[model samples]
Target chain A: GGIITQTPKFLIGQEGQKLTLKCQQNFNHDTMYWYRQDSGKGLRLIYYSITENDLQKGDLSEGYDASREKKSSFSLTVTSAQKNEMAVFLCASSMDNTGQLYFGEGSKLTVL
Target chain B: SQWGEENLQALSIQEGEDVTMNCSYKTYTTVVQWYRQKSGKGPALIILIRSNEREKRSGRLRATLDTSSQSSSLSITGTLATDTAVYFCATDSNTGYQNFYFGKGTSLTVIP
Candidate 1:
């Protein structure tokens, strides 16, 4: 069994601040994704990486940047925070894009 | 418009009762996936139903898909307090292994 780990489980930021979230997985999966969920709302895909040095944009990728430095790690950066934005950022990994997904605990972001 | 956006809404249900969540996508999909998410946690895949299959089951969860209508439904039987969470329907387009697009998700609360 493998685990996907997300760093800094909780984040507190101000409006217009830049926040970075990190994710690491030991599954050695080729695909990784970043999604954001607001309270009582559905998740929106931000970015996905197929392999090392690869990146793909999803519907909500406009304000976020992602990097796949290596096969085991993927990172997401919120270019500018918005006030009253309290959402959870989730990291996921899968052997392939259409297979079952393994998710990290998630990083909660609170913008004041 | 890759996946029909109609299946992307949330739902609420009562405990000990049965509730069904439905989804519809615009594109041709070979596989359909169902996921559950609790408060403060990442989503977890519950069941995966394929194109040729009409129904799939796992414990108290049942999922049904109709290719002609481009629709899928998830039904939870004998709901419990632990079943209070959001359910997301994901579809993998016939394009193959490109990625999954998720719906808005249904939020169910099994009141005790």
Candidate 2:
């Protein structure tokens, strides 16, 4: 019955600006992931970490960076925002790579 | 290209009707997970069907997996308004790494 919390539910950034989103989970899971979802689209993986201080890139990781500083927290950074770029970023954790995942509410980003 | 891609089907049905959503994947996967996402929220796991299992059910929801076709389907019966949401199918490929890919999603609106 643990929860995943994501900070700054909504974000507005200017073009070329850098933005960071943070996530925390109390499930003591070993795998964490960050995904981006555009309107009317599916979730695209940006990055994932199997353990603390580990990082792996996904198909859509060109402009994003991720960090798993601790076992309970994972963060994502947008290197440079693009105008009219609006998407929802989700953070998820799993007990293991092949198990069910628990997700946070999400952080919505709007670039102006 | 995305590993798992939903049909992008948007379905509108009455409360008492039944609906089914489909997803297709391009690569080998060990498991397929169905998720439901309400507005302004992260996706929630509804069912997880493994490659070894063909069908799985939970209450009013049912999921079927076909490894030969590399596809899966989710069915909801006697839907309620609360069931209105976007549905996604995620594939977990134990490719010596954690590779979980999500489909685009199917948006379902249960009309009262």
Candidate 3:
């Protein structure tokens, strides 16, 4: 069984700083996704990639950017961190976008 | 717009008791997925129910879908403390191939 690994599980950033979170999956799935979850909130899609070098924006992609440089990795960037806020960013991959999704542990970001 | 709405009520149940959570969606969806997320952990898909299939089960978990009502339910029997988590229901029915939409989840606490 392959694993999806997210880097720097805990991240601290200053207000207005640009923060990047990285995810790597060895499942070799064709689709990669980025989502953000606030406390007591559901997951909101930020961005997703259907293949290598592809990008698609989601409902919450306004303040974020994503890149799929390779098939096995997807990364998300927060353009400007909000002060005194915290959110968990999750990375997921799927063999098909409409099928079962596998998720990475997550990256917790705290903006100071 | 395809969106899901899960009951926001927080449930507390004793271990080994049965619990059920309900979710309603708007729009015609091809597939529905149920997921669980433990504290500080990423969400994982527990079951996927299609429009045609009314019910599916995996171990102690059972899922039921009602296409006419555009609603679904997840039932867990003989619950364990480890089963305490937030459960979310997501849909894959989009406007001309759109991204999945999720709703705020139901939080369940299995008390010992």
Candidate 4:
């Protein structure tokens, strides 16, 4: 079995501050994704990468940037934090685009 | 607008009771995946029903897909406390990219 690990389980940032979240997976999967989950608002895709060094934006990618520097790791950056913005960011990987996805525990962000 | 936005439905039921959750998507998709998320954790896929398959079951969980209605439903029988969580439905559009969309989710509380 493979596991996906996300660093900094919790984050607190000030308004306009930049924050980064990291994810790693040992599944050797080809697809990685970052999603944001807000209370009562379901999960929204921020970005996804199909392969190393590849990036694709989702519907809610306006304030986020993602990187797939290596095959096993994916990272997300919040360009500028907003006050009272609190959400959980999830990282997931799949063997292929159409296959089942394996996800990390998540990184919770709270902007003050 | 989100593609797979589940009805903002929250249900509280006693153990041993049966429950069902529904979701509708705005676009055409070839696969619908159901996921369960516990508090402070990322979502986990419970069932993946394809366009060709109308119904799928796993242990005490059952999922039904309707292409004509662009909707899906998940049913749990004889629920346990462990079943308390937020349930989400995701769709794989096969849009020449790995674009999987997730709904907001339905929160279910199984009371003991």
The residue ranges of model 3 lying beyond 4 angstroms of the native Cα positions read B96-98
Per-candidate TM equals 0.90, 0.96, 0.95, 0.96
Please write out the lDDT profile of model 1 over residues A4-109, one tens digit for every residue: 9998899999999999999999998999999887765566778888889999998789878999999999999989998755788999999964589888989999
User: Candidate 2 residues B1-112, lDDT tens each?
Assistant: 6666887888999999999899999888888899999988889999999899999999999999999999999999999999999999998755644667888899999999
Q: What level of docking quality does candidate 4 show?
A: medium
lDDT of 1 at A88: 89
lDDT of 1: 0.85
The CA lDDT of each predicted structure is 0.85, 0.89, 0.87, 0.89
lDDT of 1 at B2: 51
Q: Score candidate 2 by lDDT.
A: 0.89
Residue A50 miss distance in model 1 (angstroms): 0.9
| Candidate 1: regions farther than 4 A off | A84-86, B2-14, B93-96
Docking class of 2: medium
Clashes of each: 4, 1, 0, 1
Q: Which of the numbered candidates is closest to the native, going by highest DockQ?
A: 2
- Tell me the tens digit of each residue's lDDT in model 3 across A21-53: 999999989988898888777788899888899
Candidate 4 backbone clash number: 1
Off by over 4 Å in 2: B94-97
Q: Which numbered prediction scores highest in TM-score against the true structure?
A: 4
